[model samples]
Target: MVDQWKAPSAAEPAVGDDKSWKLLEKTLLAGVQEQRRARRWGIFFKVLTFCYLITVLVLFTPLLDMERTAVSGSGYTALIDVRGVIADKEEASADNLVTSLQAAFEDPKVKGVVLRINSPGGSPVQSGYVYDEIRRLRGLHPDTKVYAVISDLGASGAYYIASAADEIYADKASLVGSIGVTAAGFGFVGAMDKLGIQRRAYTSGEHKAFLDPFEPEKPDETKFWQGVLNVTHEQFIASVKQGRGDRLKDKEHPELFSGLVWTGQQALPLGLIDGLGNASSVARDVIGAKELVDFTVQESTFDRFSKKLGASVAQQLAMWMGFQGPTLR
Candidate 1:
């Protein structure tokens, strides 16, 4: 009977009969179904992978050009947005801003540039770079008008960049002025003492860790830093005066250099801004460039992944080591 079952014939069931045939049939069907499921899953994953790759490409590459729209008459203008902290390593870096601005001015189609600024301010050096670039672009393209449109908050470094524009416009409620410099930090020496934690750091120079929170700040060091701030503040004031020319009021208001912000309504008369308006409105009405262009660099997959991976690894290492060190700014 076992031999008959082993040497099976298609014509009829042998030895084990219909029961055995039925079991074999079920097994064959299950195998086929499993293969079909696997194939479908494979196809699905392939399609998903394809979509992911496409998205990565689009984000990294300049796949799409800024959509150009026709404005009133024939003149063209480009709207460039300046948002967030302007730092060397940040997304809104002066280098990137300058490149975009320069491109806008260079474009034959782009008649003028509308610098839409909305920033709380950042690095003085970065702001100065943008300021210099704006001046250079204006010199290169004298015909193309560069207008600054302050959105919600344009202060300190933000205003520094705006001062270079041909005309500065701000919204009624916009923070227009903060013509000052500041270097902020926290002293964790008290916390360290309370927690019984010791900070060990070695440096080559005496003033290398001048602002180190762990170490006690020297009076001379504090005085030296204050001098630096004063120098930078004077530079900021001089730049503003030079940019605004005779428009600024002669009144010696404490707010001018006290790091106090002013609204657009107050700014207009104070000569902090040229008028009260936003980027789109100013672009359409003043510059005659209704169409906007964003030249910001989108992060690549490699960049995003690397950053995320690095952060994750660091977090894991910190967790593993049981380190609870506070972040240094």
Candidate 2:
């Protein structure tokens, strides 16, 4: 057998020579290496996927309607927390408030609804929608009482919504009133001149560019803008008067419509707020229920992360593009 298995000729190359064994070993080693690399990547990706799922679960789970403990007994108080600016886009939106209100009214166990408001107000239209919804819900469910409990600051449109409630309560230090409207714009005529940049703007109508800040503000234009502001202010005042009615001491206090915000303590005397209290106290003492369920739709993790990521990417891109904001700090 040894004599028959002679080494192949040089021209034929190594069929089963030392080189052949070496080549086969190299190929096998390469295959093993490839498999190891693939397995490492697979493990890494699996771990990454697991981590991502865990993070999303932890972050988003809080926003969903957490399962409630079974209420064996009778009456319940549904707590509706309305925090931050009352804008349509925000968590404390008109839609969110309406949904919470509807839930409270629909729940048979929920005896009353307590609106826990902690906001500085937002768009007039948004606040108006919320106010109207609250009134409508109350009318539809007459038995269920609705109370507005203010915390921190609830002014302007916030106060407007609160006025629709049966009773308004607040902490003494809370800012309670700002019955007014305002529009502000920067006059950049001087800045433009300094920068040697002219804002060449054209309009079809004479008053179309009435409040153009890049150009000099004409005396007539200023007067026109003032008139617009006055009209909006009048509307706000009218709403307040209508909402409060006999309770408003507009005639007795000349400064009622002066856009002066007052503390909850000062507000009580001025008839801006009913009394001083928080949401918990109102839920327990006033509503006569201990169990409170928060009906506010908390911000979802995906939304929060997306916003943060978008902002971060935007900031990085802006920095790379050499763009600076008004306050660099």
Candidate 3:
């Protein structure tokens, strides 16, 4: 123990002698070099991130168009894609569609506009906005014809949008129209009764919990709700009739507007579609423009980034609740 504490002789090497000092110096130098290298990488990533964000901003802004329009060839048909469910926060949202449509119409080189629709349809309100915008734009630009060319499926609200167009075209096998409105959900009151589970709910207003699934359905409330749906359906029918005008032989085919869908080939006689043609055919033959320019406004990178963060948190919660997550039909 004493030897352990004892001071070394003059000839004996110090615990931290020149050799150890050299090793220590080397370790410190290596650490500093590593830190400098890490900082350089950090700076590089930061610059890369900045550039990427700038590019995204430019894509969403008018700057990209301003730069490209000078070289963009003339008389190309501006194509705006209206895919997926037309609802709030969706890719086919009214806001996004309207913006894209306006951009397509505003382009001087664009001879006409093609609304390429392939949607199962959703949100009558969102679809209504799009329908109105198309009418408004058509009034503004009488010469620039707008056409809706359906692919795969364009039903319900998607059909609503197509009705407002100058003409609608689709493939022979394309599912064209489902002219109706519906609001549906499951009722858990009977299930709760069988399970002997009590469900509690509170509301300040009587109609606040009007359609609460946990409570028994009220006949008067049900009647009122059905009336609402009926009114919306009536509006849909009126829009279709008004758009189609003399072309629609609705009296002969009364079932056409009764929430039943029809193929593009079958729809021509009902006047739901003008002809059996795809986007390419419409652009080539109808619009007399071969070149197609896509004006669809894609979601921004930042929008996707934020949505991913939200989805991550929601998915974690869903997992805890024993939900496997949603799958498309």
Candidate 4:
């Protein structure tokens, strides 16, 4: 080799370099293909999950309605739940209650209807609507008696609804009765003054902005608002009298309509409730229909999920903004 003294050929190094480059290129292509396959699988699983959820929702919706229709041959007591605030869009709203009542009344197998109540009350207007409907339905279906059984708390609008029943019952410790109207809101004037925030609201009418919490409360407006509440209270009193009839022991009791909540034991003497019992006892002993079937209109699964997601946030926002109106409770 020394005698020859020839340099190594350049093609030898080029051939090794080309082989290394080809190996690197093959590795990169394999990696890219693997990533593409993973991405495709991820998309497929996501679509599969979406389709599963949709199928579940579709199947669940009919089952809710089917519950109302699946009455037994043996007569059963129809149970309608009035749990929570009795306002529009609430679970125990007038519309839902009315629908449930109508369904129970329509079903021939339904021996009696029981309103299972556990609420602190809500809108007077909504309560009034339900009250009227109950009376109307009672007239339409005299044999199907409606009973209200308060579990925990049934005051204000809840009481208003219970009064409409043929008979009202509750546990001895249950809270009952709050026959009055109330409108509450936060006055932000002091807070705004401290924060140096001037609220500029333009309006056409003189009393258009009377309830504006940012402004100083006027004596005249306050008087007018009280008058409105008084009128609503009077209407509530009249309805209660109509519903309870002569069962109300003392119609002129000073604290009776002063929005005082009482225990079931105390309410019995006041004629607010007929007896002490729960939904089961009322259904079995009172109605003589031991078998129970729920007639409550339930919210769809998707709607319930969406409400759970957004309801709390929206409620907090409303409270912070001081957006309020007259509520029966």
Candidate 5:
């Protein structure tokens, strides 16, 4: 027993101890190999998923096959959609519409351009800009005709832009015109008095707070604003007259420009619309283009998502910027 207590030999260890060390080393090596294999597979699947997503996105967007969809040797008709409120920074803004119109007209394969409108109305200034640009573009490309085709409704500022087109078409039951100008705001003075609330505001100019909702109504301000609306309405009537010329039956309809909306059937006699036809039939029979190429500027998916996420923030920003006026709705 005393001899067995001596230290193990340095040259050679016991059989059992040597075997245990060899097994431990082998297990660790196998574990490292398995981990490496798992990591490689994970990286491969991630790259494959990324590639699949990219391919799907490309197929979904128009940019994928623009040449095939837009133009061919037979020629095509360009369609620019004017939908929703025609505000400065909105989807139907003058900048986007005008840009789309220019591109459509400039394309040689496009024999004609169509302004497809479906809107209530919006800012007069934005509509004016789009109207003027369309006129200018027509002058530049005299050979390429521009037609406005109203869907269910095209009124107010929408009609302003449509008037500039070479011809305006609409469905028989469509609401064609609302040529007018208006500005609307509320007066909260009476409500505040009933609630026993006091309003405080400071402005540099005496009339700067003239349109404040919480302040008492001012007779002079109301008169002044009514006059402003009348002036703008007059401008709208003048533009329509200039655009329509002899086609308009002004004698028969005295209230044609009095913010009166008319059906497409009534609009024909009023010279508010030229004919009744949908975009497809007009493209096929009128323009002689079976293939229709839409030239509308669509907002990106990310941009729409961001707008939804920041809606409250946008409202706050708009509130800070006061007195947005000259609206044609």
Candidate 6:
């Protein structure tokens, strides 16, 4: 009777229940902390790997350039490439070309300079800048002759640059010459009208938004824009004539500056190209230097990557918005 019945107190938990709960909570907490630690380590390792790669790239690029310079040796033909659109930030830009030309001319080891061009052409302003620089550099270094060798295609602004060379050469099948200026954009006025949309563009001046694609075509504005293109075309033609110095057969072919492209063979008879040859042929036979050394100004890998990541988006946006200037194409 004494071993029998004293009721359990309500304040007390069941035997082992409290201890089991405490153990479970501790296990959960430890697991969460461990997971967090692993995540932090993963991030750290990823950052470390990225830094290592960048360091290796930065350290080795200069060494590669030095090796190229050593291989160039004492005397060689300096080759500057003009490949792609001749725009402000492009590979064939005025700044890059001028810098390359300067480096080539300043070097006593450079017997001659060759501009290897393969472009469909781009900005007239950039081309003009390069043309002016080439002339100035030629005056400064009369011994180092600058020759342009057109590869696959050299038209419009590209031809403009080539004309500045002492003598222009091209492959017999190469496309050359397109001495013209054009400003092109899409007209969204009709499309907007069809879609029952009204364009409301505010501007300080009346003709300020004349070239706006969302606006209706005004006859007066059209005439004014044509006049602007005509003026730019005239300037381009004048530069070519000045550079070629009577080599152009404009008298026989009035359509020479009508934006028509010609093959290298056709260009020779028409006085567009002086000779038919490639970069190697010109280097060996013309410059008398069989060993050709590249003097093209190349952007570093990091610079290229950064630009593509940043500026390319903005450039595409500007183009899509129809805000374009005169192009020599």
Residue 297, candidate 5: Cα error in Å is 0.8
Q: How does model 2 score by TM-score?
A: 0.76
Summed over model 2, clashes come to 0
* Clashing residue pairs, backbone N/CA/C < 3 A, model 3: none
Per-residue alpha-carbon lDDT of model 5 for 147-219, expressed as tens digits? 9999989999999999998999999899988888888888888899999999989899879988789988789
Clashes of each: 0, 0, 0, 0, 0, 0
- Single out the weakest 10-residue window by summed lDDT for candidate 4: 320-329
RMSD (CA, Å), each prediction: 10.0, 9.2, 8.1, 7.4, 9.5, 6.7
Q: Better model by TM-score, 3 or 4?
A: 4
Where in model 3 is the C-alpha error above 4 Å? 1-73, 300-329
Local distance difference test, each candidate: 0.78, 0.79, 0.84, 0.86, 0.83, 0.86
Task: Give the higher-TM-score candidate: 1 or 2.
Answer: 2
TM-scores across all candidates?
A: 0.73, 0.76, 0.76, 0.81, 0.76, 0.84
TM-score of 1: 0.73
Writing each residue's lDDT as its tens digit, candidate 2 over 39-125 gives 999999968865774587586655443433345267778888888888877867888888778877888888788888888888888
Q: For model 1, what is the C-alpha lDDT against the true structure? A: 0.78
Residue clash pairs of candidate 5: none
Residue-by-residue lDDT tens digits, candidate 6, 72-188? 666889898999999997888888888888888988888889999999999999999999999999999899899999999999999999999999999999999998988888998
Candidate structures ordered by lDDT, highest first: 6, 4, 3, 5, 2, 1
**Quick one: how many clashes does candidate 4 have?**
0
Off by over 4 Å in 5: 1-51, 58-63, 67-70, 301-329
- What is the total number of backbone clashes in candidate 1? 0
